[model samples]
Target: MKTKLVLNFNPEASNLPITHNLIAEYGLLVNILRAEIDEIGGKMVIEVSGDDDSTNKGVEYLKKAGVGVRPFKEGVRRNDEICTHCGVCVSICPTSALILDHETRKVTFVEEKCVACGVCIDACPPRAMEILI
Candidate 1:
């Protein structure tokens, strides 16, 4: 099974080799989708693939290590009604999930490619983008 998680790190947790331990100690594949952590602390988005037991244990290990872990239930959602097709989000999307259709001059959201990074949510002028998790 594959699971997506959002990790909140404090200064102490930031210093730890969390991802290394998650892979080496827990026997899981860790793919970091987005990471903003620095010396102080920040958030990270990661996807882990493994058996259910391993995944659960990895989550427990993270929590025990003083890192906050939350399941990323869903990616970003766009409110079509509120969207102006202004294409503000298109330029900022890291995964190219939001695209501007040149012919129609409208923005298109390709949900499959989104990593739920929340960049588009902030850039949207109409406040049409939101993260479901």
Candidate 2:
């Protein structure tokens, strides 16, 4: 099974090798989708793939280690009515979740690629991007 999570790390938790431990100790495939962290505190979105039991245990371990974890089904959504296809979000998206169709000259939101990092939410002029979780 695969699970996507948003993790909030405090100052002390930031120093820990949480990702490494999740992979090495829990035997899971860890993919860091988006991360903006500093010595203080920050947030990260990660996707982990493993068996149901391992995934659950790994999440439990994160909580025990002082990491705030929130699981979500989907990340971001775009309102087609509001989006102007300005391409501002297309350039700023780290994951290329927002794509500019050259032929249509329109911007499209590919939800599957979104990590809910929220960069496009602010960059969007129309305020079309909404965070689901």
Candidate with best TM-score: 2
Off by over 4 Å in 1: 38-40, 86-92, 99-112, 121-127, 130-133
Q: For residues 15-127, what per-residue lDDT tens digits would candidate 2 score against the true structure?
A: 88999999999999999887887868978889999999999999999999999999866878888889888899888888898899999998878887888888888888889
Judge candidate 1 at residue 66 and give its lDDT: 93
**Which pairs of residues have clashing backbones in candidate 2?**
none
lDDT to native, each model:
0.88, 0.88
TM for every model, in the order presented, reads 0.75, 0.77
Candidate 2 lowest-lDDT run of ten:
71-80
The local distance difference test score of model 1 is 0.88
Per-residue lDDT over 19-128 for candidate 1, one digit per residue giving the tens place of the 0 to 100 score: 99999999999999988867778788899999999999999999999999998756688899999998878878888988899899988888768898888877888899
